[model samples]
Target chain A: MTERYVYMDHSATTAVDRSVLEAMLPYFSEEFGNPNSLHIWGRKARKAVNEAREKVAALVGADASEIIFTGGGSEADNLAIKGAAFARRDKGRHVITTAIEHHAVIDAFHWLEDQGFEVTVLPVDERAMVGISDLESAIRPDTILVSMMYANNEVGTFQPVAEAARICNDRGIIFHVDGVQAAGHIPFNVRDMGIDMLTMSAHKMYGPKGVGGLYIRKGVKIQPIVHGGGQERGLRSGTENTAGIVGFGAAADLASMRFTDGSIEEEVRLRDLLIDSVTSSIEDAYLTGHRTERLPFHASFCIGSLEGESMLLRLDAAGIGASSGSACTSGSLEPSYVLLAMGITHELAHGSLRFSLGKDTTREDIVYVAENLKKIVADLRALSPLWKNRG
Target chain B: MYTEKVMELFMNPKNAGRMEDPDGVGEVGNPRCGDIMKIYIKVKDERIVDISFETFGCASAIASSSMVTEMVKGLTLDEALAISNKDVVNALGGLPPQKIHCSLLAEEGIQAAIEDYRAKRKAGVEAKA
Candidate 1:
């Protein structure tokens, strides 16, 4: 018999919604035309692209003109960080970001550092929160940008983006928020939050992959990382991914509709059920992210003496799709930097597992997952020599 | 990724559990690296009569431990000592490059068990004298 499959790795990538796919279908074949073309077909393609821009902009409260579509979330982040930093080169050589930012933002800052830009990687608290006071202290006359993630991908803890943005605004330092993981799951308004620039991806929010957008608040100058035919306001230059952009627009619209319809609250309820069941039933199983201040659909844990890869393998055998921050899973000898940044021991970090739910995730799915996870963890622990010491 | 043989062995290892009052026990690896294997052996007349292992690691580590135990069962102490990591790797068809360390740990675990058994035997003889 085919095993029952349960996907609990939405944070990694979500399945595209049906409506989003439906909206994208016509753009791929019948309505295929270069948006830059001036013909009727081109006008049709350009109209769809512009409508997508509006839908995406409406999702984040940004003006349609300020939205720059890119290939994916990482690209958006790179453009936001490197573009802004390079554009302001003569003004300052300093940048500030949290250590827990995704590798996209972190690596961009690292590249800037290699190019002689001074970068201050502020440490996070035990709950994976960067200190506002530290941000205030890190700012200097030369600090050109402060790029912090709106939410952590691995742990799901929401960061203080508003406060961070305000601090940067006061210092005249450009603020960029990597909102890829937080965009659809949480309610956000870039204008209301005073965000100078923000990055978000479509695939993380039930939209097609290979499509993402960077929101640059009006008058925020940034150099283009990819130079071509001046697409996306010359900030990102390439033929627009017409189908992907349409799908993204549909996904964004759906996300906004769901937000108003109270579907996210249902997700949160099921998420808490999964979290409570696993943490309470299993010995030495502890939640990794913040207890209360976290994404509604995300739950992570580190079970003592159980390697994440082993647990993932067992979970896979049981037909559950999950992700892990364990060193073994990553094929590296080091565990997740996010957990390590949170001051978790390497041993505990090796035991990390993350489960991010989705809109279609039902109570039955959570119950099945919680029940199987208990057995899987216990069985793996039985095979674990380290587990012998836990008792 | 792992071979079907590795997955099969990992799913139902031949001898997995702690042996009560075993003749000797060997433990290797550490929790920091997310792999630890403890092998217990019961020897009779200088031949291995029984063996079991408790391992904490990815699928390859557990498969290596299970394979090594199956290979050494019923063999004399000298023959068991001759089992190499390469032998364990070959016995399991093959392991990934990074997983070669799992076989090495298995080899070291068996050797450590034999050493512990010899030391215990020598101590027992000394006590009688």
Candidate 2:
């Protein structure tokens, strides 16, 4: 048992890929120029920005002109929700979203509610999936926009977005999908899926932080949340994050290889192994998301009565990096809102754990994590009064 | 966001697990709130002879339970009841502001256990009479 450091918290963030970093390096110093400038230096910078946009657009089957680069995923989400809602205010004052949405989308809706917009939050099933009929019923005649996530961040449950999109399309309401967690991991074409707008974050892939893009279908009405020098076609106005955008492009370029080179299949194999090993080896452990429809790289669970933070600490001691949806881990008094929305009890949700695999994850890594997880869970359960009284 | 001392106690809690045929037992906190501490004590001559705990909580809760049990092991019932959550926090080199509630659970657990012991004693005397 040599010391091993296994990183399984890819949903939180990922290490920047070497090629992505290399692509970004020249832009910071040598290729440095403001895309907003009119000089030769500015043209060179603009070319790089355009190329990055093309690559990002290609990843989602969107046109380069349709992709609006933003600061990050949350900013992109805010812009999509608020921008679309404000742009269509004359047409409607109603909006809808799901209960399992990321805080980025949920909080934006909260702000819209404060602005006197009628907002409907639809609940999910036990699998953390929002029903399409619920979405259809929630849409009012005055509904301006419907924002839903492609895949849930915490539980990895893929929403019925394509169906949801068609429903919104028939109603003449705008549909926005938060694809921050699903974009690079799974293959989705905005055009093919009839998706109007999609959000993506570079950090969720192997790109640098502080750079993400939103794909807005041409003619989809969205005003700029940010107003400044009319950059990003007046949708996002500022000097472009040239280097970070370049890195994001490089990462997006690499993401396509995973689909073509059987890498995603490999990842799915490892992910299933990890899920099976953990669920079978531990007692009273239940998988959190859709068993088959989850992301290829995600496996989440809520074990017995021990708190999540305690399990995380024990796992950390064993040199395994993981994440938990426990209230204690978040320094809050309530467990994960996502888990609760799925009808999980507060006591069981307190034990939530997530392990998001990466491109480099291997079979050995899954075995190591599973072995360590079983021991940690057992140890924490031993000291838990609730575990002692469990039915 | 914990001190090294708190992590130490959390990783290797001094008094942990269920006790058999204990003289007194007290459980505090709620499962819904994600913290519950159960304290068990062995009393001899109105003084705690042995103590253990089974806590379902975060690191701080478990550490507080271990710290309180250790602090009251050799103390009389009155002395144990006098110990405050702030004392437990200080003994663990202070907890984060949000985690201070965990220490309170520990204090309440010990007091409740002591009360249970006294009530049982009175009940025994009345039954004998």
The digit string of per-residue lDDT tens for model 1 on B8-124 reads 998788889888999999999988888899999999999999999999888899999999999999999999999999999998999999889999999999999999999999999
Model 2, runs deviating above 4 Å: A389-391
- For candidate 2, write residues A32-105 as lDDT tens digits: 99987899999999999999999999999999999999999999999999999999999989999999999999
Give stretches of model 1 more than 4 Å off: A389-391
Number of colliding residue pairs in model 2: 0
- Tell me the deviation in Å of residue A269 in model 1: 0.6
DockQ scores for all the models shown? 0.83, 0.92
Query: Each candidate's lDDT (Cα)?
Result: 0.92, 0.93
Instruction: List pairs with backbone clashes in candidate 1.
Output: none
For residues A42-72, what per-residue lDDT tens digits would candidate 1 score against the true structure? 9999999999999999999999998999999
| Model 2 chain A poorest ten-residue lDDT run | A382-391
